[model samples]
Target: MKHLAALNKYFWKYRFRLLAGLVFVVLSNYFSVLAPLITKYVVNKLMLLLSPGTTHAFHESVQDPLARVLINRIDRWNFSNVVALCGVTLLVLALLRGLFMFFMRQTIIVMSRHIEFDQKNEVYQHYQRLDTTFYRSHSTGDLMNRITEDVSRVRMFTGPAIMYLVNLLALIGLSVYYMLKDNVALTLYTLAPLPLLAVTIYFVNQLIHKKSERIQALLSDLTTNAQQSYSGIRVIKSFVQEKAMLAFFRNSSEEYKTNALGLAKVEAIYFPAMSFVVGISTLLTILIGGFMYIRDPQSMTFGTLTEFVLFINMLMFPVSAIGSVASMTQRAAASQKRLNEFLRLQPEIRDKPKATPKVIAGDLHFDHVSFTYSHTGIKALTDFDLHIRKGQKVAIIGRTGSGKTTVAQLLLRMFDPDQGAVKVDGTDIRDITLKSLREQISYVPQDVFLFSDTVRGNILFGNPVATMDQVRQAAKQAVVDGEIAGFAEGYDTMIGERGVTLSGGQKQRVSIARALIKDPRVIVMDDCLSAVDARTEREIIGQLYEYLQDKTAIIITHRIFSLFQFDQVVVLDDGHIIERGTHDSLLEAGGYYADLYARQRERDERPSEEEVTQEK
Candidate 1:
């Protein structure tokens, strides 16, 4: 309930609709209560007409002049006429009740749907704003469940649960007021079972809250298992572990089933319990009203007893709904609590209040920067320092886990350093807006990611305003224009998820084209060419050299591109810089860079086994 308070603003947003719905609830209940009173009037009139001898006495017993006139007119009417009148009146009341009920649902339920839409958008937008660290700590399944399933539960509370709750209160207040007006003692007895019913509901709801929380948690786990299994289906098939995966999923499903059944068993008690309470109220109304009538016929009439019984029966549906409303409320509370957990989380990285957008010239510098992953507690960079002037091309070559990617990440401001600052154009990056910083720098990661879209669309993502000619030109520079042209639809061909429809080298080249399309001041290619063969790689380097001459480029890779002359070459090892000089100077020094270049050149010079077999 406390967590559900987060939706207060949405409720306030739709306050007018909710207020209209409330008025309809009251109007609907008013008509509903009128039917029982009309039935009482009809029954009393029928009795007077049937007993002709007592007709005069009934008229004499009526003290009010208004009632006397009404009774006399009803007495003159025929039996069939009286029956028809009562039927018509009840029908009209039912029609009115149904109309208002429709309006009630229209306002309340529709508002709930609007709130659901807004809440989902809020969660998704927050997810987008969150830092990478948050994503690393959370699973995709759980995130999906919160926005979808949890929001749906909250919607039930906002719409149906609230509507029914209002309906129950309106019906009870009207029915009880009329019952007491007719006879106090009988009304008290008729309502005696209600207090016990309330107590029962209270205890039952506590159990329901606990069980509902467990069920929601289990459902999230189940959804996560299914999502993970689907995403990793290829891996499972490759490993021949389908059976093992199925067994794991089956275990989770069985546990969820057991808990769900337990909750159902608990919920199953509510209806019977409610029915039994209602039955007791009905029995009390009959017995007590009969005794009071027998003791004094004038004090309690037959019509009065029928009316009291009708009131009790009218309360049955609302009383029965109490358990269900409570169940929904509990479930909604549990879900709202889960939703609040993520909604309240502030992203680790955000622009300062006074930060302003600025155009960048790509004079990048890492001054005594050090960073360790909080999740893994592994120091990736230690006092790492570098300086790249504008329009300079630098290559950082290192083995795996040598902090090569960390430089790109820091430059992009994905994670701020713990010690030193990253600067662009003599300004600390933290002072610049994230959108501005990222827009000027294009990054092509080692692991390329592509949307399930046309090849043209994926390339245009880097610059939505770029022309088709620019897209083709960028692809040509990346050496993927020929491969794309060979496709049946050329640039319009739809790629599978993560570009599964394309080969590994094709995906990397497509990513390179995406980066190139941006025409950014700074382009960081982090081992993006690893998937392509040496020949293709050299061809791409040849094309990129001219295109990147005016742009600042930082190429991070393990392999050295001997053909591409870089202004500066850096050798990194174990989070420290081992060498920094021109490629020729590093080669002359005969250090780690020299050794690595030697090995790669030797491997390239060696002939393939297939070529030797062809020679034989």
Candidate 2:
């Protein structure tokens, strides 16, 4: 219940619609209570005509002058006409009640939908603003469930649960007022079961809240398992572990089912218990009213007793709905708590209050920078120092785990250094806005990720405002324009999820094209061309060199490309710079760089089995 306080803003936001819905609830209940009153009037009038002796007594008993006059007019009317008028009146009341009920749903339920939309967008925007560390710690499926399933539960509280609660209050208030006005003792007796009903609901709701939290957690796990299975289906199939994965999925599903059934069992008892209590109230009304009437013949009439019975029955739905409303409220509270867990979290990285955007000129420096991954406790960079002047082509060459990629990550400000500062254009990267810093640096990571969109759309993702001509030119620079043009729909062809529709080399080329389309002052390619053959790699590098001559380029890769001479080459090993010089000078010095370049060149020169077979 406390967790649900977060939604107060949304409630206030849609206050007008809620206010109108409240009015409708009252109007609907008002007309609904009238049915019982009308029935009482018809019964009493019919009784008077049937027994002529009671007509004079009924007129004497009526205290109100207006009611007396109305009764006299009704008594003089024809018997059939009187029945027809009551029937018509009940029909009209039913219509009016239904119309207001419809309007109640229109206003309240629609407002819930609007709130749902706003909440989802709010969560998604927060997700985007959070730093990389947050994403690394959270699973995609769990994040998705919070926004989708959890938000939906909250919507039930905002819409149906709230509406029903208001309806229940209105119906009970009106019904009790009318019942008590007729007879106090009988009304008190009729409501005797309600306190006990409330106590039962309170205990049951506690159990339900506990169960709902567990169920939501299990559902998130189940969804995560399914999502992971779908995303990694290719790996499962390739490894021939289909049965193993299926068995794991079945186990998760079974656990979820068992817990859900446990919750269902609890909820199953709740409704029947509610109905039983309401039933007791109805039975008490009849028995108590009968005794009261027996004490004195004129004390309570059959028409009044029938009216009391109808009022209890009118309250039956709302009262019985207590179980459902309580359950929904508990579930919503549980879900809102889950939402608040993420919503209340402040992102690890955010623009400082006074931080202003600055234009980056690509004069990069890593001054005694050191960083260790908090999750893994692995130091990726150790007092790493480097400097690159504006418009310089610097290639950082290293083997795997040599921290080559860390350089690119630092330059892009994905994570702040623990010990030192990264600067762009002689300004500490932290001094400028994160958006401004990231926008100027185009980083094509080793693991290329592409959205499920058209080839042109994926390319345009780097720069949404890039012209089609610019897109084609960027693709050409990456040497992927020819491959894209070969597709059936050319640029419009949908590249499946993560560019699965394309081959490894083709995907890498497209990723490079995406980076190129940014046209940033600093471009970092972290082994983005590892998939392409040497010939295509050379062509891409040649075209990129021409296109990026004015912009700073930092190429992080294990392989040494001898096609073009770079301005500087830094060799890294075990989070330290082992060698640093131009490619020719490093090869002349015969250090780690020289050895790596030699081995790579040897592998490249080695002939394939196909070539030997062709010679034979």
Q: Which candidate is the best by TM-score?
A: 2
lDDT score, candidate 2, position 83: 81
Q: Model 2 over residues 389-439: C-alpha lDDT tens digits? A: 999999999889989998888888888899999988888888899988888
For model 1, how does the per-residue alpha-carbon lDDT over 1-616 read when each residue is reduced to its tens digit? 7888998999999999999999999999988988777677777766766765653243343333543455566667787887786688689889999999999999999999999999999999999999989988888878888999999999999999999999999999989887787788999999898889889988988898898888888888889899998878889999999999999999999998999898889889987899899999999999999999889866777788898899888999998999889989989998999889888899989999988899998799999899998889889888889999999999999999989998899899889999899989989999999999999999999889999999999999999999999999999999999999999999999998889899999999999999999999999999998899888998999999999989999999999998898999998888889899999999999999999999998999999898899999
Residue 61 Cα positional deviation in candidate 1, in Å, after optimal superposition: 12
**C-alpha lDDT (0 to 100) for residue 259 of candidate 1:** 90
Candidate 2 clash pair list: none
TM-scores of the models, in the given order? 0.95, 0.97
lDDT of 2 at 334: 95
lDDT of 2 at 120: 92
Quality of model 1 by C-alpha lDDT: 0.90
